[model samples]
Target: MVVLAVIIGLIFWVTSDDSGKNTANSTDLSGTPSYALPSAYSDPSASASGVPGVSGGSSGGGGGNAAAPGESPAPGEPGIPGGTPAGETPQPVPASGLCPDQNISVVLYTDKPAYVEGEQPIFTIAVTNAGLSECTRDVGKAMQSVTVLNLAGDRRIWASGDCAPVEGVNNQLLKPGQQVKDTIDWSGTTSTPGCETVRQPVAPGAYQAVARIGEKASAPITFNVNRPAAQ
Candidate 1:
């Protein structure tokens, strides 16, 4: 009887130990309990949908950062990547204004309308700004010409540029109603292309004086030279 009781106790002990091991393995395979987990932990795809203050999702389909509503882009700045804002026209950059030839006027004058046979003629060339705005111009000697034409056959008698050295640039800013004047004294003589030899004096007669700047010219003014009376 003592041996049989010992055998029954041993059998009960072995069965209980095997049952405990099987329960432990089943618990491991079943994972955590549903009631113990947080509510948001149920969905694994929630993280990829984007969380507040966190950037998420793949690079396609407007997944990048964006400006908030009611926000405006900086002035003259591009709003979108490689794109311009709709309904906005680009402003043109301003440029410095330049002077045109139509705004200038040239006038020629002589100290006296008539001079004695031996007297020299004093000539004046005046350039006036007739525009409403200010402008710059090259008023150098290279761009000026003084010509005298005899009325007999409308012959060209003398030109200031024929014997004068024209050098240097005279760029000047001309304001509205401004005038620039230049003066020269002309000998009672004539000049040609090569001024190597002395020229004879012009005959006392009626002549027209004209001044020119670039392609623009002043209106012709009549003048006269008289023969000297016997002393």
Candidate 2:
């Protein structure tokens, strides 16, 4: 009976030892410790931003949601990244396709270079498109100016804009070598800065007429206003 018990004890000890060895070798099969999961195993629905199914970075592996190099935003869209909101239309960009200021020329002329006192001054402004291609310009009162200055060009005596309200913008497309002209009759009287009211008639003297558009001005044309001879 003692020998049989000894054999049974040896068999049991051997079986227990083999079971522990199998458990240690099985780690490679699961690729994870029994107490913890692998680092790569994460919830499929969760993202870094804490939003489900929505990723933080760019799609297609480009890294971020920015326009590609050398690409511009479509018109009416934000000009730069993180600019205008998604739906708001952006302001139009000024076009440089039109002719430059150097391609335009202005000329001021009057019906009579010498005017008798109390005679209305009939003036004309001529603008020529001297460019090689067609271009557009604002020919409205807002962009046009006619000024009368003293012979020395030191004193401004009158201006077309003083009493006139610039109604609206008039953009005209001018062909190359084309000319545009306008005429106005000025009261032979001085005016204040605002032209709110006409001042006294200008004294008999030599004066200059100047036509201007923005910073561009025509060559000054001289004229004389003389008192009428007594009958």
Model 1, 43-108: lDDT tens per residue?
565565446556565567774355588887435645666554242231221244444667778899
lDDT by candidate, in order shown: 0.78, 0.80
Worst 10 residues of 1 by lDDT: 85-94
Model 2 quality (TM-score): 0.56
Question: TM-scores across all candidates?
Answer: 0.55, 0.56
Query: What does candidate 2's lDDT look like per residue over 45-70, in tens digits?
Result: 67856566778664575544567689
Q: Candidate 1, overall lDDT?
A: 0.78
Query: Model 2 clash pairs?
Result: none
